[model samples]
Target chain A: GAGVSQSPRYKVAKRGQDVALRCDPISGHVSLFWYQQALGQGPEFLTYFQNEAQLDKSGLPSDRFFAERPEGSVSTLKIQRTQQEDSAVYLCASSISGALGGELFFGEGSRLTVL
Target chain B: AQSVAQPEDQVNVAEGNPLTVKCTYSVSGNPYLFWYVQYPNRGLQFLLKYITGDNLVKGSYGFEAEFNKSQTSFHLKKPSALVSDSALYFCAVRGLQTGANNLFFGTGTRLTVIP
Candidate 1:
């Protein structure tokens, strides 16, 4: 695809339910990132992957949040036992070099609503 | 820890007038700064970044940002505003200790260009 793609643009989950959001980055992007954007707030970093390695996940709010990029091109974010506070737009982005100053290409995020 | 701040919750500008969105950041070392724009129901779109070059950085849609290390600020500016430019703007920063992969963002500012 010409741009990053995300699945289930909108997700409504019951409290305690498990939900998964997927991201397919640009064809050759090397760095993938996950962020959570709460209403009226900027996106907060959740996790980062370099190739298939989960290099940084220091931003995951709790144990319920998990993310993986098994093959390096596609990634999934899983939230277990979802809570109302988990409601937000989950954004996925990818960069070609993974450099600190590189611009990222973002996908249309998946808006998750936990009831 | 690296952090960015966007003090204004919202900003309004008349079409054809100049517009500015202020941002300030704190980091342990030389910072990597970025600006992103988000339209309603869409993901972030990259605008510009300030790495190690001249303080002025130009980006998409005739937008530009000025990096002021003395003030720890990176303010987004446009010479002429358009109603179509109304959107949410975000500022982000990454420091050496935070690694090159993860970005810390500030609460966004909603820009309204009134016709």
Candidate 2:
């Protein structure tokens, strides 16, 4: 089976610009998660979705960050007015169930560089 | 609050020698611990997880993790290190007792297996 996939493996954006990263979860996955990883650091949670419902967005660092999963199959993480501090690899993961114990499959991630 | 800790910034091991990557966690209640690995320029891949009923959990690529309730540790181990095993390792924890759907990740540990 194909693993989770993210588009635009690398993106360079100017400060104050808006950018969108896409994620395609594994087929039939019901849970999707987004994370941010700074250089030399582990990933930090961003948001979560169970099907089309955005279950948690508390981990989002600021209001500039937004995410949506309209149909529950593909998801997008959008950053408005990007800042240099937002430079990092954005990761997406999906799991079969919404349970905390379910194994998550991750994608290669989209590396965004804001200058 | 739920959190995970990887005390070592890096671990170096000689090929054919045993290797260990330590992780400790703190949460309000019983936790579900997991291990993930990421090669350079790649996404995180699930290695193993400890949910319940077992202290020793075996995972992909001859890797295993031992869950210690007393120490609140889940240290990843491999009997014989291979150069290909060199990568960044992450430890994650979620509070199963509270049904928290979020995973708290530790500051990852870089593992270098010298051939």
Candidate 3:
């Protein structure tokens, strides 16, 4: 892909419903990350992956938030029993290297509106 | 813990005039700073980063940032503002220590470039 791609640009879910968001990062990107952005706020780290390994999941807000990058190319974030407070934009980013200075390329984002 | 603060929620600038977006960071150790911009329905684009080099670092789209160690600030600046530059700006910081994989982002600043 020319750039990072995400699916379902917008999702409206009732409270307690389950939702899934997908991300296809740029080809050959080694690091994948997920973040959450509330209205009028900056993005917050959710999870991180290096290749197929889930190196960090400390940022996941709760056990309901689960992310997987099984193939190291495509990733998915699943949120179970969505709550109204979960209404926000979910962002995915990829970096060519996992180094501290690597620049992360982001996706257009998947907006989840829980009502 | 590493965190960033974007003091201004919104900034308005006249086209062709200079523009500035402020950011301050806090970290236990040295910090790796970065600036990113977001447009409507689009992903965030990386502007610049400050690692271990000089204070001023130039990035894409004629954007630049100054890294101030004493003041703990890394402000984004553009010599001339353009209407097309109107968008959301974010500042992020990461600790330079080992196992610091996630970047903490500020709340973001909305920049409106008036013509």
Candidate 4:
């Protein structure tokens, strides 16, 4: 893809429900990242992957938040037993280089509304 | 831990006038600072970064940021504001430490350019 693409641009989940968002990064991107953005806030780091290896998951807020980039191309973010506080936009980004200092290209983001 | 602060919740500027969005950071090691812009229903777009050497770093969309090591600040500035530039701006910081590659973002500043 020319740019990062995300699926389920908007999701409405009831309390305790599970939701999964998907991201397809740009072609040949070596680094992928996940972030959560609350209303009126900046994007918060959630996880990072170098190729298929998950190098950083320290930013995941809770046990309910999970992310995986199995093949190094596509990634998924899963939230289990969603809560009202989890309502926010989930963003995925990718960079051509594996280093974290490189410029990141972002997707349209998945807005999750936990009701 | 690395963190960034964007003190103002919003900044109002008139078109054709100069605009500035302030940002400050704290980190254990040398910091890598970045500025990104976000539009409604869209992903964040990287504006500029300050790594080494120069204090003033120029980036996309005629945006530039000054890296002040003394003040621990990296403020984004533009000589002329445009109504189309109205968006949300975020400041992020990444430290030089091995395990500190994850970016810590500020709470974002909403920029409103009046015509």
The candidate 1 chain B region of ten consecutive residues with least summed lDDT is B97-106
Q: Candidate 4 DockQ score?
A: 0.66
| Per-residue lDDT of model 3, residues A2-114, tens digit only | 99999889999999999999999999999999999988888888999999999999889899999999989999999999999999999999999899888899999999999
Candidate 4 residue pairs in clash (backbone atoms < 3 Å): none
* Cα lDDT tens digits for candidate 3, B40-74: 87778999999988999999889999999999999
Off by over 4 Å in 3: B98-100
Better of 3 and 4 by lDDT: 3
Spell out the clash pairs found in candidate 1. Answer: none
Q: Of 2 and 3, which scores higher on DockQ?
A: 3
- lDDT by candidate, in order shown: 0.93, 0.94, 0.92, 0.91
- Regions of candidate 2 where Cα sits further than 4 Å from its true position: B97-100
Ordered by DockQ, highest first, the candidates read 1, 3, 2, 4
Query: What is candidate 4's CA lDDT for residue A40?
Result: 84
In model 2, what lDDT does residue B63 have? 100
Give per-model TM-scores.
0.97, 0.98, 0.96, 0.96
Each prediction's DockQ?
A: 0.84, 0.76, 0.78, 0.66
Better of 1 and 4 by DockQ: 1
What TM-score quantifies how close candidate 3 is to the native fold? 0.96
State the lDDT of candidate 4 residue by residue for A4-106, as single tens digits.
9999999999999999999999999998999999988889888999999988898898999988888888999999999999999999999898664787889
- lDDT (Cα, tens digit) per residue for candidate 1, span A11-90: 99999999999999999999999999898888888999999999999899999999999999999999999999999999
